[model samples]
Target: MKKTVKILSLFLIVLTVMISCKKDTDPADKDFFVGTYKGSVSYNKSGQSITSSDGRVTVSKIGETYSFYFGNNIPDITGVKFEKSGDNNYVSVGSGLTGITINASSLKMLVNKDGATWTADCSR
Candidate 1:
């Protein structure tokens, strides 16, 4: 059954190729961003805003979700899930009142709630 043997060989080759192929993955998907960053911070409320260059932030992952903790007790934002937004960049998904955009070297945050706002431009 030479024809049967040939068909089996082709099927095996196709299976090997399918098994060896890899999916496109981003570095941010591989825990490249779990760390601490420090830079500028700003907060505004009721027509008054305070700014400083001493901001600090820590990023942690539990399972597949990420959490952002800010210095000065700014209230940690939790349960944020990120999706790849660009080259080395990630943005939060389905988060209310808090939004973050981050790359390998920098992060920016904007939060608005109850007539108050907070923003940070930070870097590792």
Candidate 2:
């Protein structure tokens, strides 16, 4: 019984360490990025048939809970989460994520609904 208790204690300690490491490794401040981003995307399937739209995407950051949205008539889309990997690098997450890339001069991504990722240059 004593040996089993020691093993359990060690396991708990390892788990706590892992959780702390995860939090520390997320090395980006996702606070300043919450805003309405305007851009456009190109859609093509087989040939050069494509359509582009000037749409708006909004991001709201309330502490650790980040909510995102994008749409045409109404911004009904939500839960566009991102994991910031570098100084200006990110990717989307949710039921299905379309990659979003942000930089000093470019705010582009192939939206989740699109057949492919489209990059539309935007301004703050």
Candidate 3:
């Protein structure tokens, strides 16, 4: 009986340690910065300009990267990479991309392609 008790105790201790040390992800980790945001948007191409106050941008995770779909005549941005810039902020990383910043409350985009510029300040 004592041998059985010792084995049981050892199993419980190992179980406790395994449970305590197991890696766990926070709520923020599962978020993946996916959401829809809306605000102001402006696009300028070939001397033609368009602006709107009800701009929208939807963010989603595709594989390992994020996709940005913009509204209000702004072009959609895809396959862009971002890295953590602050406590809840991320900045885009790539060439020919001026800047992209995302946070818990807002998403700002500024990119120029083929002399066309698209900018948006969105929130969710």
TM-score of each: 0.63, 0.45, 0.68
Off by over 4 Å in 2: 1-33, 41-53, 103-105, 113-121
Clashing pairs for model 3 are none
lDDT of 2: 0.52
1-124 per-residue lDDT for model 2 (tens digits): 9999999999997875454334223313534334556666454444443434676555555454445455443323345566666676666666655566554444566564544433444444
Q: Can you write out model 3's per-residue Cα lDDT over 1-124, one digit (the tens) per residue?
A: 9999999999997875444322331113443445677899888999899898987777765445777887666677788777787687778888766488876677788888789888888876
Q: Which is the leading candidate under lDDT?
A: 3
Worst 10 residues of 3 by lDDT: 19-28
Q: Which segments of model 1 are wrong by more than 4 Å?
A: 1-27, 31-33, 44-50, 113-116
lDDT of 1 by residue, 1-124 (tens): 9999999999997775443322232326554335676888777777676677897877666556777787875666777777777677888777374478876677788877677777889876
What's the distance in Å from true for residue 108, model 3? 1.2
For each candidate, C-alpha RMSD in Å? Answer: 13.0, 12.4, 11.9
C-alpha lDDT of residue 51 in model 3: 92
**Candidate with the larger TM-score of 1 and 3:** 3
Candidate 2, clashing residue pairs? 110-117, 110-118
Give the candidates in order of lDDT, highest first: 3, 1, 2
